[model samples]
Target: RLPIKWMSPESINFRRFTTASDVWMFAVCMWEILSYGKQPFFWLENKDVIGVLERGDRLPKPDLCPPILYTLMTRCWDYDPSERPKFKDL
Candidate 1:
């Protein structure tokens, strides 16, 4: 469904797609993969996700996600797209 749960903050606010946004979506994908396809932000609707993210809320690490992997995931979800790590750095 390409839900809001997979969107980066910049992607949400500015409607711009970039490598950083791709990183953010990929991190969500990683979370989904590690969680065995569990939905990201299962409780939130599309409209709510933007405000939640603007408030600095992010997906919690899945129980199956390794701590080190979760750390990298959070870096990919950085509020500022420019601050996100490059794919090469991952």
Candidate 2:
């Protein structure tokens, strides 16, 4: 099963998915890669993910993730879909 942590707030709350949502998922995939496939939000239960996301929380940078990469990830998770970087910009 895919981790709930990869779902964007819009996708979770309103069933909206778009390229911006794909950007969010890509960020989570990057986090997993940085952490050697470690699951995102491993400490949280699946049911709690949406609430945490609604609260504007996001996964912290992995210890080994480069600053630039983490910055890109955070941008991808921006609450406003329009604020996310285009895939070409990544």
Candidate 3:
């Protein structure tokens, strides 16, 4: 099981997993890689992560992450799962 911080909000709220969930997690992984393994939402407790996401908050871009890459990450975290980009496009 993945940590809550890496989970898409829909999956956290509804226990529903889909290709979009994978896309969300992939973006978290990308953030990890770019941030040198830093945890996503490191400042928030696991239980609180969901509420933040529900409010449309996303992981802040790492200082060194490129703008284009950060844009991709944000797209992956879109609230509407259908709006998230597919892996092939990433």
Candidate 4:
């Protein structure tokens, strides 16, 4: 299982970490786990993460990412946060 960066029922601690946000994080962790701890988006510029997130961007799927999981990741990072899926369903 992935580690919890923050925990709260109503709100996650980080400014951007909600249940949906955690699902996104989980998607990344799942990639890492499947790849034996491989780094993700390593080539992405440092600014890219923030730029994409602020502008509602998503990371490109890594080669090893399975189709089902990729679909879930896309859901997690939906441009409208409300459109993101709940962690419970994941």
Candidate 5:
């Protein structure tokens, strides 16, 4: 899920994982299940994940996924954590 503990420890210490991150993880998990345990970002390196995350980008979801679900998944990866939906809404 969201790595709340994986934040940077700077002087300002604005390090905190949010619900958005959790949603991202959930989407990743869904992808894994849909692919039957196939690797995610297998073709991409770890840095790619970081880059996409930093840029508020998400993995290209499967076309079979319903549009509603896909939209929710993308919302989970929102750059602004506050813009993310809550668990209840998810």
Candidate 6:
């Protein structure tokens, strides 16, 4: 089973998976890497992550994360898949 923690909003909500979802997963993985493997949404249950996203919240930028890179991460988490940057553009 895929880790819900790494799932995109679409994948979690409507079972839609696409390149954009891949982008979201990549961003999350990057977040983990930058945070020294800290788990995303560590205090929330698997189901709660979706609600958090629907409420327009997201994983906070790490204190040490560069602003520009955090911008890219937010882009990957955009609610609308079409607005996310393609892998080629990252």
Winner by lDDT: 3
Q: In model 3, which regions exceed 4 Å deviation? A: none
Q: How well is each residue in 1-90 modelled by candidate 2, as lDDT tens digits? A: 745678988888787989999999999999899999888889999889998887889999999888988988999999999999999988
Model 3, 1-90: lDDT tens digits are: 657999998899999999999999999999999999998899999889998998889988988999999999999999999999998887
Model 4 C-alpha RMSD to native: 5.6
**Cand. 6 TM to true fold:** 0.95
TM-score of 5: 0.68
TM-score order of candidates, best first?
A: 6, 3, 1, 2, 5, 4
Estimate every model's Cα lDDT from 0 to 1: 0.90, 0.89, 0.93, 0.58, 0.58, 0.92
Model 5 lDDT per residue over 1-90, tens place: 433222211201354445555655676677666666767667765434565456555666775777787788777656666676788987
Preferred candidate (TM-score higher): 1 or 3 = 3
TM-score of each: 0.93, 0.91, 0.94, 0.62, 0.68, 0.95
Error (Å) of candidate 4 at residue 9 is 20
State the lDDT of candidate 4 residue by residue for 1-90, as single tens digits. 223221111222245556666666676677667667666656565434455455655566767878888788777666555777887787
Comparing candidate 4 with candidate 5, which one achieves the higher TM-score?
A: 5
lDDT, model 6, position 9: 88
The prediction achieving the highest TM-score against the true structure is: 6
For candidate 4, which ten residues in a row score worst on lDDT?
4-13
Off by over 4 Å in 1: none
lDDT by residue (tens digit), candidate 1, 1-90: 556789898777788899999999999999999989889988998889999998988899899788999999999999988899999998
Give every collision pair in model 6. Answer: none
What's the distance in Å from true for residue 87, model 4? 1.5
Cα displacement (angstroms), candidate 2, residue 89, comes to: 1.1
